[model samples]
Target: MVSSSSAPGSALPGSSSPIAGPAPLSLCAREPRVPADRLVAEMVPPPRFDSVRFGTYLPDPNQPSQSEAVGVLEGFAAGLDGAPASGARRGFLGFGRSKAPKAPAGPRGVYLDGGYGVGKTHLLASLWHATPADPSRKAFGTFVELTNLVGALGFQQTVQTLSGHRLLCIDEFELDDPGDTVLVSTLLRRLVEAGVALAATSNTLPGKLGEGRFASADFLREIQGLSAHFRAVRIDGEDYRHRGLPEAPAPYSDEQVTRVAETAEGASLDSFPDLLDHLARVHPSRYGALTDGLTAVCLTGVRAVPDQSTALRLVVLADRLYDREIPVLASGLPFDRLFGEEMLRGGYRKKYFRAISRLTALARDAGRLVDA
Candidate 1:
């Protein structure tokens, strides 16, 4: 999620710089101990949603889509001011003694669920951006980032920190891990009980969470129960990823691929598998360690990434590389063919789509460098 001020160069690591040398430590050499506040801040920067107003969302004529979802979100946002006192209870007399009153219940939140690349993140970001500013009153981030924060900060402390926010807007809300499911369930329950309004976007509906992951019945039940407290809205349409896009070109020529390979070999590039292993072992903050003193990544034998977790990690890697403008060279499959049939329908489909898109752009950039 780090932002770069300029695009990275296409030169090899040690080609231009006299003092360029191997990194002192590898990404897996040590664990990253990022502070909780810093992690949250880095992960939840204000989204680029200035142009994403509700009026701009065009819905599909054939299906119930973004328009319906937008209406529900607007209503929910409007009702926030009239929300009842949370946890309020009427005073009661017991043994000729009167008990103090508690706060009343508040308005429920909204959950926007849809397929991959349906602008779920866009709408969520728009909602957060349109809300009037109040310091420490709103929180917006992807579900993965929040869960990672919870792991780093501990459950209770993370809950306390987030509960203070008046609204919580989460994107890509899907449960693949049992521990994360439990932690998120508990955290959401606490937030709702404390009267924090919520707005979230997800590819999977709450009831269908962890469908193929062999999730426990109790965990599924918890998700379903928590879902009951939110207004569920389904945004239906074709994936926006494929809309108005030109046809993809053929795979890179042998010479084009060889050019990148030679550059990497000259710079002694790291393998993608090694990077993936390191990513599995450390926090995402540690991923920066992979790019240290490195100019290019050459990945081969990438015929098909079958596992959903691996595909998701690849998505993150692609994002980091794209943000840094790093050139990547890969072989063994075309960009569009890297994903298997099953993976296209898996929970990580959106991530896979993103990875393919970014990788294609990077490949094109690399091809341009070779052509030049």
Candidate 2:
């Protein structure tokens, strides 16, 4: 938990920056390193299952999906091209290229932010990976991995490496240390003045990242002004962290699903709350929602629906018992019928299906096609 209330010009966790003076890199904040084994074993999941059938193929790029990526790109391109666009939207990127091409007009210091589970990392990574690679035009992305860059190694080394890149992408930019904030501020200011196109992802908006140390009003003023230099695109929906991985949904227990009655059964007790609590603890994202359990059924496992421009793929299992097929079962929230592009209707719908191609390996390794 962070202290939302703090005195002026103070730093959190013994870290402070000269708010109005020389920024120093000596004694950078010490953040712990993530165990590499965990990353190798768990962070990366195994392949998808091959046995089960998943519903409708995801929308390909030839068609538009429910996602707002195209719109974002169009709007952004308009900004660069010069036009009075609109408010911020989620899951989209900059739009068309401006024929007039005005200095790549985008808001500066605008930190792209959302809840913990949202697809901030995925979006950032995709942005970096997909960015047009032109050495003359540089693009760099760094996952801060800590509340600050104080303790992270290779900051200056990385700075030297990326300094010449015209386009920069910094992922996970949270400024927990005041000193680190000054360094970042300096970096960002220089980037802006140089007319470099910069993009970053942070759990905290630039100002709030240093909440305890920076004055909220001043922080907001500076950071928001920074945002004005870049285009602020909000990525919404459930956490992308849970969204995709090449894994199959295997039945944990066959008996659990088979025990269900042919007809509706009565409640054993109030298991819903416990189940929800379990989900909150295990899955670790804001993207999931508990649908009706038919008054008695308990969800033994869950699958996160990952949001992508191509498709909204769902996670599910191989057991037939888990399928709640009756019309009454569908009465609650939308999930079963919610095939990715089904709700979206437009000319772009056709192209979105291309996303399904990538899921092929995931399904084969971790899942069977859903029963027809």
Candidate 3:
């Protein structure tokens, strides 16, 4: 995190003018290359949540489910020791033989079902931290990162790598594509059979993961098989980011955004459309690296995303910026205007809503820079 020095708009010691520092870097110009080993090594929670624990989560007293979820997850983490392995005989691709016996009867994992900004990621990361096993025996990542790992390594290697982990916590669990659904379903089945525990958090319930996004009927077997591995835990609460706070500040003028981008230390300035096009070239797994060392992000000529693919990529970028708590200063349309009515109502609505929530919060943080 970047520390504040001499308030927001003040000049540096040697700089003669307020906006005279070196020009901020352009995020559109960056193309990060992440090796497979680094992907496996960086599977833990992001920096924003590295220190969160069960005690750090303050459940709204009005919502009993919030407190209940904390207790249930704490118990789940404590029970990981000496968990029994499945009795089914392992076979090729990690599936059981036709004659293999049934596995033990119990909920193999817990799922946190909730909406955006209700601390779902916070609780999911907390479980990863609270688990009794060593760091190497547990893994935490978003649904996108998990699938990217499978793509980087072959399916068999991905299963082999995670099967040894005692616990795997997936944040923002998604079922957007049919292929991803089948791939993750088969992989999880393999992990469960090998005695690995699973946990996840998402806006939709396990049973209804792809309801609005895809033809769920076509993939019912894969979807149902995915749901059976976990017991869904519902968390009810409004978005904590703006529950009682004032609305996020309006978008800044392009000139003002340019000034801040040039003046702020370790900031980046990018035109919204160019950045979107650049994102298409970079892998989603590299988005986190794309924002590394950025103290602030400034975008000019912001407008609505043109399509679902671009909107999803922007969502991933918003998540990385929020994970680092980096402030955002932008020109043109506000964050709430970034997605259209149709896109907001589609199957990936939750993901879009989450991006708006996080980006607005960061925009509010940037207001301090403008007022200085």
Candidate 4:
């Protein structure tokens, strides 16, 4: 947590005190509130991908599936027709009546199933760009952000808000909890029924979601119902972040990180453990807001997370920071060592691997600051 004496724009406890220039901010002290309207408005792609389009995506020349996914998704987007999905409507007699033109014969959406850093997000966002609807008629966000929106505005309100969209692109679809599985499953079903198209990218195939994370058998119907809505596209490739690229640089020294934090404009400094404690205090839905204005993140005494809960929270924070393209400078254990062997071997290992990949990329970006 933030020290009691640390005022806004003041030096955080872990940073060197009495340093010159602007004081480093502390993420531990921030508690941001995102209104329902802002949440709805910000559902578009994050800044890192704000301008990504189909032409901007570079599929691996060696991976045919990657290229194939592009063509398939493009065709899927063209089929959207920029209108609500054709479904049953109420008749004058107060009975359900099917629309004259039948809905398309096959799946109502496309699902990109692949490993981390394979450009799944790129393709998902490109599809969003390619869809023939106005920005207000389409939405793009991670599965967690979508669920968070639902949490903020009740379920019915969420459905009403999204039901009119021509396309909804969900990135990083998760199936870690049974409740989320049911919630999102029901939500997607309602949206699909409402004539709204869908698309998603995930590390796991739709059919295999929630398999190892929970007692999936208990919710097999919901899982299968979710899977049935999309045509699963399998994308196979090594992590693009590290492929043909040099490994991430070593951690910076504490003094180096603190110096950069104190001198760099818009930098926030915090001890890694204290930041984790602060994350616990704030809801995960607001993690994006917590990182609102940070240009860089500096951490000291970085070490392995103590448990699965803390590790999971760290994953969400890592994702939010990555989405905002914030550089992370840290001392102590490297990001690859932040999770234990047991955690890496567990059901949520994919999330952990993606977090490591993203953090490593950010760490590499932060190296330039030290070099300067």
Candidate 5:
């Protein structure tokens, strides 16, 4: 399920009157793709004090609206069940080998810069929920994606969870306005040197994220440096906002979804061999690295280790592996994502428990695995 929040950049909608003067700047200009309704809903008044679901009902003023957020969340949720669409290909700048015509080490900063919507947050969430299998592995910290406040405090908070989590995924990375230049630039380099994997999504491109700011040059350099660290996979085609909405995706057959779902619902400790065989038989040529049965296939051919249930529920697989005290095998999975600090934690945190618990209940009903 792709996010349904993308706005068409080429043309504008809801145009009643022609411009009176020169063309407006991009920021003030209305986006063509996002519907007029969404913008209004986003600006809708916050929850009232007398509201029933007060604590939880309030939406973040800075984040995308409920509909857009739901688009991302639902798509993320579906990912917990099945594989992604064909159009969503990750373009790495430094992930593949020299012969592969792709970067090996990855572009520095690893920017997910692009237009609004199109699943940047979804990608970040998937990377977090599915990629890493190890608790000891290092990833970077996810500062408040809304505030972009990832500084010394963010890193410290992450250090508490486990050790060496190096992959940092920032959703809605919109720093093109300024103020974030000094902080982002200063800490980003340190993060790289510390061997942290950086992943971020933004509505603005690297050059534009810091546009017009005095720190623009430094920010650009920072982005370039970050790009050098990992490859940038751009989902440049259509806005996938309508992707995971209700009607189950029909691209792949039920057999594939069923097989993967079985792995998702299989014995907590068991990674079925049949699943690996199935992936070997069906793993898309472009996406074979997504899941190598239980192993995570690396672009550089590094045999990291095998976790469990790739080709199945990574949200579940990750937690199951953590419970079993296992390390994530970076050999094969659905996507090539970050494994550092930010990835260990994500929006799908709740799904991990739900899927595992649901699988556990099902297994007990089938009388295979023990409930206790």
Candidate 6:
């Protein structure tokens, strides 16, 4: 939990101390209030890793390559804990490299790149947990969240605010928009300059950022320049998100829907787009006013959410509903088809994947409610 004294910047709600810099441009403007508890909850390490030590990330028969990755991550975490630094190294890309250039003097960081659900987040979370606890000395969150905060608070102010942290852990380090790519580049440069260590997880390699739509030479060069600051390690394995979960049942049958309709006394039915719009208007609060006064939510017209922004918002809503144990009945499309092909390729993929996993579990729980 972030201590009151260490709040990122005076921009955050309830922060009293003024950051030492030029006055904020928009003093009265405020970002939507996202509960601090919710943000911290998202950053908390999963229970499975609570007792697991860095050295205990043993190799699995199914994923032969994971052992090497685990060792690399353990070393990186140790380095964060004051162990000898392993000079800047590139991620494992199955290519022999010539002798690398000497690393400059600075606090070190690591970038763990891998496939969706391949434990990059887990590794990064472990590092956060292993670090000695100090009030306001660490910042951990998804890259998107950091970027959103930067958007609400100006870039320089955000950097000044975050520079106080000894470590920054960012998940889903991806570049979609050319503007975001540039913003992230500047943010990384500033953070490094401030001597802050970063541990980030991403589905895309730094070189492959903005691969299809906005891949420009200048953008790629910026990514490469940032990549030089950290050792990039790849963790290759099958997505473990649904490995042991039961197969998702087919979309709720009409009889099942009718049963829910009969049992849920004040259930509200809504469209996916409507939900997305409500979330958009009220974000960074994941659940909006529409969710208030609702015991259950039934969403129809749930065909492929084409827009990436909407899909990401849906992930947050699913998380909120799941946390509250609110049953959801989704119709119009099967669980697997909720996102289009393009969404499955980029940074948004992992979020959508997690949303599907949680929603599938919630749908089952909703089914049980209907049966009861």
Instruction: Report RMSD (Å) for each prediction in the order shown.
Output: 7.7, 19.8, 6.7, 4.8, 24.7, 12.0
Alpha-carbon runs more than 4 Å astray in model 1: 1-33, 43-51, 55-58, 61-64, 81-107, 205-222, 249-271, 285-302, 306-309, 318-332, 341-372
The all-Cα superposition gives candidate 2 an RMSD in Å to the true structure of 19.8
Best of the two (3, 4) by TM-score: 4
Clashes of each: 6, 64, 0, 1, 59, 1
lDDT minimum window of 10 residues, candidate 3: 211-220
How good is model 6 by TM-score? 0.65
Error of 3 at 30 (Å): 0.4
CA lDDT scores, all candidates in order: 0.58, 0.32, 0.78, 0.78, 0.32, 0.58
Candidate 3, 171-252: lDDT as tens digits: 7756556677677878877887776788876444333534322222323344466565566777778889987898867899
Pairs clashing within candidate 4: 85-195
Query: Where is model 5 more than 4 Å wrong at Cα?
Result: 1-109, 135-163, 205-227, 242-372
Candidate 5 accuracy as TM-score: 0.31
Arranged by TM-score, best first = 4, 3, 1, 6, 2, 5
The numbered model that scores best in TM-score is 4
Query: Which tens-of-lDDT digit does each residue in 1-372 have in candidate 4?
Result: 223333444555556665554567888878777788988999988888989987888888999988888888887776665344434321211112334243344666777777678888988888888887889989999889998999999999999999878788888767556678678878988877767778876544233434222222323344566565567787767788988888767788899999998778878888999999989998888888888878899999899999999999999999999988999999988999999999877777878888999999999999888888
Task: At residue 372, give the lDDT of candidate 5.
Answer: 16
* lDDT (tens digit, per residue) of candidate 5 on 1-372: 111111222222235544442221111121123322232222111111112221232233443443343344333223222221111223322322223222223243444433333434444544444433342342322222212223323644323322233345554343433556445544555545443455665433233322211222332454554544443443432223323333211122324322332233211111333333333433121121122122111111212124333423333233233222222211122122212223223332223223333233222232211111
- Of the two candidates 3 and 5, the one with more favorable lDDT, higher being better, is 3
TM-scores of the candidates in the order shown: 0.68, 0.36, 0.84, 0.87, 0.31, 0.65
Q: What would the TM-score be for candidate 1 when compared with the true structure?
A: 0.68
lDDT of 6: 0.58
Candidate 1 C-alpha error for residue 132, in Å: 2.0
Q: Residues 6-96, candidate 6, lDDT per residue (tens digit)?
A: 2223332235558663221210122235554444434444333455555555445677667777776665554544322222232321111
Candidate 1 scores a C-alpha RMSD against the true structure in Å of 7.7
